[model samples]
Target: MGTTYLTARLNGGEARYKLPGGHPLTGRSTPDLELTDDGRLADHLHGGRALLLDLTDDPELRALAAGYADRVDTLTADCPSRPELAAVLVRPDGFTAWAADVGAQALTSTAGLAEAPEKWFGVPAGAVTPG
Candidate 1:
């Protein structure tokens, strides 16, 4: 397969890519695979939509995930080594779009959660299709 790394800036930091499924915040994990309507997850998103892994149950954090659900499959689960993150955005190709740290400020800001969709999904909110 061709290289999956696509770089774009997020959260005021220059974009960085670790191989998909190779890092705590980058890879698809067991929970990611186990989560589905029938308890089966695809290795890659069949459609182009991004996926948001909401590892936290905090109402505020869940709301944060929901705000982005228009462009993502927001799933709540226990992730490995992600205690510091409120959530992680996984692209359709199973790569991380962005990661949110565990802070009320960070979780609540549009800056932390919004930038990745534009950078990764190439579509604005309420759009019916993604590029």
Candidate 2:
């Protein structure tokens, strides 16, 4: 079992859990693929908050993900011959919290994109609370 699994089992920390064939990117660690635009991915993977990556250079995806900028480290990269993944919300531990793979699946994933951050990291940065 992976360290996250063992730690979660032994020390009672957060566990990634089995995803049961969701997006291939979901529930997995971020790939250490080189960034075409520059910089190493590992350098930013643990940047305090979750890291939201726009890997395919999609403008809409970047704009959509930017909404969580205050809660995540939104970044763009051109990963050559990349996987089907277009965007991903990765936790500080380097595991994926949420992901939107390319092609048709992106549609389904994007629909729930708005909910991913809040699900993993609590409310939005500027969300209003009940009086």
Candidate 3:
């Protein structure tokens, strides 16, 4: 699944939450991504382990970025101005589980952490303990 789709799914679920936005944009197109930052949508991928991909200069990655940008609203948050600087959280099955602009928080709450591990890391519900 794509970042937009995954974000929508997460928002629909009980675990939906937002973080205060003040994250700095990084990667090859930092300047472009920063232009779209409005600080409304809180970055959910804050502190948890994440998979970061640098697609700034890759054509294939750029194509994937376009697909994600077009469906930004569908994912439940403002899309980064440049999708190439975006980072997507992936489930063990290789499905996109969440999308966050670069430098944004990945996980900030127990619910967010639980959802990520269960949905993305393939960890069972019982296996995760809230902090």
Candidate 4:
């Protein structure tokens, strides 16, 4: 569901949708940070250069991701299957820029998405030091 939304926004092409069919527990027993039988979700994140976070091990990170995700309704969700993993992305300013599983690929990978952050976001230029 989320990944579909992102593909449309980022790719600007027809969305690809897939439904996972199997036992309900297929994703329940899997690790949060790791991809489940549904590989598309993980693939989208990796392809987008987004960070995947497991909050169960780190409450602080979870809380932070939760807060940021809340700000952007499009970026957050309650992962019933993987409650421990709180996926997140850090903006150049050290704030949670965006948070989502497979759905956020577009926002994270889209060209000029990072223009708002003068420090970093768009094209990757060599490091700039203080004058």
* Candidate maximizing lDDT: 2
| Each model's lDDT | 0.55, 0.68, 0.34, 0.35
lDDT of 3: 0.34
Better of 1 and 2 by TM-score: 2
The predicted structure with the larger lDDT, 3 or 4, is: 4
By lDDT: ranked, best first: 2, 1, 4, 3
The TM-score obtained by model 2 is 0.70
lDDT of 3 by residue, 28-125 (tens): 11122232334422232333333323323234333332323322211222345555334433322223444344343433232142243334345432
lDDT-best of 2 and 3: 2
TM agreement with the true structure for every prediction:
0.50, 0.70, 0.24, 0.22
Which regions of candidate 2 deviate over 4 angstroms?
1-16, 19-21, 105-111, 129-131
The residue-level lDDT of candidate 1 at 128 comes to 83
Candidate 1 has an lDDT of: 0.55
> Could you give candidate 4's per-residue lDDT for residues 1-131 as a string of tens digits?
99988886786444222212222222122233334443434433433333334322344444433423422212233445665334544332223333333333333334212332222243233436568
Model 1 misplaced stretches (Cα beyond 4 Å)? 1-48, 61-70, 122-131
